[model samples]
Target: MSKLILLFGGLLIACLSLSANAAPLNPLLAPLSALTAKDIAIIANDADPMSLQIADYYQHRRGVPADQMIHIRFNPKTKVLSRLEFAVQKKRVDEKTPAHVQAFVLSWMQPYRVDCMSITTAFATGFDEAFCAKGCELTRKSPYFNSISSLPFRDYGLRPTMMLAGNSFEDVKALIDRGIAADFSQPKGSAYLLKTADKARSSRAVFFPKIAEGFKGVWPVFYMEKEFIKGQDDVMFYFTGLTQVPYINENRYPPGAIADHLTSAGGVLSGSKQMNILDWLKAGATASYGAVVEPCNFPPKFPHPGVLMANYLRGSSLIEAYWKSVGMPGQGVFVGEPLARPFAYPSK
Candidate 1:
């Protein structure tokens, strides 16, 4: 009878150990305690597919619940490129998607205060060869340049491109807002518009039911740069990284396929405003339709997994710093705060 009791106890311990090992881990915050701010920032904003994976790893490892992660942000660099992130914050604003959304927004706006000289300087050399021949000037004489002459380059939210109206931020924001409100899976058209209206109506109805009711037929319209969407390495990177988790829905691509797409030549080179000119080579002026599928050359796996790991650690550190600076954690991760000064929102 004593031996039988001992055997049962041993089996119980073994079962407990196996069950503990089977539980999933969080990637984002687990690595945080050892990382620096710079590394955290890099990992948070890494262009690799494993960004969110990094985030989740850290969160789970630290025993931080998903609801405790009040905010998130891409690296500072992503904001410079206008790769906007979106999220819906919780009312208490902890460990929710809102923090991630806010962090990305603040990072996206960092370049707004860039110095005029530096902004012009950055573009001057490239513009001379690229646009001077086409009668474009970086000086105040050009209306496009003139509008931003007095402001710092950092103040520029979105750069003017050759789009129908050039770098259209309103168009971009509208599209993102509409997409999120529409739950990301909505098809393009009136369905999205009606969903957007429903959100606004609900919000307004709480305070002004009659007024909200009167505002009917209002619809959301949006436009976005094809290049931004097509060249979205961060999106593919984050989604793929999350897939590394056991059961996350985003893990559709075979383990290495996403990394391949991110570093591919076609993925990297195909989305530039200037590089689009290359497509003309594959087609003619009058040709109606065709597709040029080229690919980029990148490492089969991460060129430096160690460096990638270090950077992710650094980015998480910055996120911690931003929250501390704010005194209270707000929605989304923020490296820094915006100035009180108001800037014009881009409009058509």
Candidate 2:
């Protein structure tokens, strides 16, 4: 990749040499530390019982300071929120958010979209049509993409947001517990980068060789040319692309594990013709990403495996790593425990 394309917001790509068998290149600037509970603000909707319940559970589990909670009320049964409806509510969140809060945990699942923009992107960048595309075109690029700053909002005026999403209240609770269980307890786990036969979906395979080489001695980066992974017990990170992935339930996803399949409407969270990222979460993965709208097959729209691992293994939280991986995130939703850092050292 050219330096101009890899570069963003005045940050250089640090010589991204992707040639096979080449010396490792630096992909991420090591952040000072992963985001802690205190750095994240919780936004809960009073109208949704599930929203309120999840917020309370997350706050209690993560030890989020009571003052950091921001409450808003809206009918939570709808599938999408219009720009006006979202702007009014977003104002409340931005106004009430504590200055120290660096990121947001949206404690609900519904209203995943604001017009054409995903709600996560809406919250992260506000409702801007510049992020929406008419067809096969580029959208807004995130200033936080592949960035080194641990405090995104403080550094770039962007608060990376994540949803504590699940099929049921119990599922969300388990997700939170997994994140808590993962902190500072870095396990020896495998990072699976599967390159499937589906050419369009597997456009990301071009990035695997360099990722594997860079992470060789530090973490086990397995670049496999398989359609799907099954029966593996040590899975910590898994990335691939497909409309509907199979055998997801067959593998073991350790606590704090992050996985995703790049496909349209995977961010829909439910009722889409394609498989959603929630499948990974339910199958034991801590976090995943998918576009809420049809973002075409642009590799920048999905999580770059290299960027994801580079940040995550360096002790950035799940939200930070996942958000940084995607160059353009206007169409996607990020779901997971925001503060799952399995590889973090306590002293850092």
Candidate 3:
């Protein structure tokens, strides 16, 4: 009996040691303490690679606590109280394990009532309906709803399948008629996007002034860089809805003269820096685009050499097309034609 007791004590020590060596889940949440709100905003708006970089940055800096983990026990009755207490197990349950530290950081939000939406499940392969519906709900409930009236968020819930294939304002109007929060006002009434006057209608800028005008206050929402600035029609959405910092680019060039120019014009310039997407992913929160690709700068595919040169000269790190698919704060992807610049990366 004494020998058996000794053996159990040895096992407990081993378990504790193993738990100490495990990795963390939310590595980026910690280091974020050092980052300014402007920096966080920058990374949050950048594509998926940069968003992940922000996540990783906090992970390494803050790490996870052993108490916030998953564990297992066989006592014939796995009670909820025991399960929550023994959540941090020493052994890894899955090879594709979340970094031990990450789990702790993610769990931290639970205590604060800040629920991190399950984007993976939301955008899962068979959950298309849920995806569209959730997107609509979020847009409606979010404080920034008024800014994105031109977006087809309302149609997603009513015609989930149709939305998967892309949609138009007419399609959404039908959904709006069916009571899907479709009331939109631009410049208080009409003639915002549909303005006949060339000057009122002209200007290759979207999102910034338009959304700012629409919301009448700054409300954070998904933001794109180059695309928002190139199309004069794009700016109309802002005028009709709630958007904040309309001039702020999601992915921006370094803090310098170029950034000032883009902001003033309600445009963004990407590819000005030589940042590696993967490294940015590792950083957890602070990432940026390079300098050259401003709004209306990079044309659709097969852009002229002059366009490419312009991008190169600006020192922008043009994100590879595929990397920009996953958007953040929410997983909103642009299904438009080839002209659409890289979209946002979803926050995991």
Candidate 4:
């Protein structure tokens, strides 16, 4: 019996030693700390009260420095801007922003698209006609994809941007607060990938199996039918299709969760049968993406679930992950908190 006890003690010591020798898990995600207040520039349309208000709220909530706030004068009512008008605005932003500012927060929903390209894409990589020339061809590749550097503009010459857009100032404020809350509280959640009836909109389904495979032990992944998932308090990621709402009332999304639908005019702020991207924010999602113009069934124009999930799982900020997922972002506007990094730290 004493020998057996001695043998057990030896086994316990060996196990502890082996555990101590094992390598620690390196963080695969980028947290909110990756983006400093100095790294972001907030652009506001001085002519628009709502734009200015949202900008002020975001700057305060995110603790963005005073010099990082850039004001530009433009027709705030217009939904689309001509290339020339956009160029002038872009020039102003370039001139006003400090050299170190790596990302932009546009404080309005209108003028989401500049000619054929989304304002966010144009601001990131400048306007490239090739991106809009063909519907089916590949677009310009983003240099910031799967990038390790937080200074995207400095490292890759690309500045990812997101719109602080919503139906009202209160909603925008809530959205910003949610982003901040997410940074403070990193919740355990699941990523839901839906298989909808619409084939064109459901192209992301093909990548669902792979996404499940990738997130096996890291996070729970759900691949379900067209029905809206309900009563889930930990929905960190969701991708789906439809024109109208997709029954989100039943789900409770944590502060950093991302949800978006694939449909024409989901980006359109005005009248459309489809639900607007801002609605996702209203419904608790911290970030979302949509095409302002008619992008047809072009998969490149929309966020690729596989790329988005992979990058997010790798610790990329919401803006970087979403921006990197799209191959052709010329017509799509990214709306949400740009710096929400729920997966930035290692899971406890």
lDDT assessment of candidate 4: 0.74
Q: Give each model's clash number.
A: 57, 0, 64, 5
Q: Compared with the true structure, what per-residue lDDT tens digits does model 3 show for residues 1-348?
A: 122122222322222111122121111121111111111111111222322343343323323222322232323121111222322321232222332211111111001100112211121111223222222232112111111111112322210000101022332222212111111111111112211122322222232333223222222222333223322222212211111122233322221111111111111111113222212112111111211111221111011111111121112112111111111112221111111111111124
Q: Which one is best on TM-score?
A: 2
**Cα miss at 51, model 1 (Å)?**
25
* By TM-score: ranked, best first: 2, 4, 3, 1
Local accuracy of candidate 2 as per-residue lDDT tens digits, 1-348? 122122221221232222222223243234337889889999999999999999999999889999999999999887899999999999999899889888999999898889999889899888999889999898878878766676788788889999998889999999999999999887879999988888888877877876776665567889989899889998998998888989999999889999998788799976689998888999999999989999998888888877777667777888998888888889999999989998787862
lDDT of 1 by residue, 14-123 (tens): 22111112211122222223121111111132332333343444344333344433344434333222211221111112232322122222112222211111111122
Q: What clash count does candidate 2 reach? A: 0
lDDT: which is higher, 1 or 2? 2
- After superposition, which runs of candidate 3 have C-alpha atoms over 4 Å from their true positions? 1-60, 70-205, 210-348
**Sequence-dependent TM-score of model 2:** 0.91
Clashes of 3: 64
Every candidate's CA RMSD: 24.5, 5.0, 24.7, 9.3
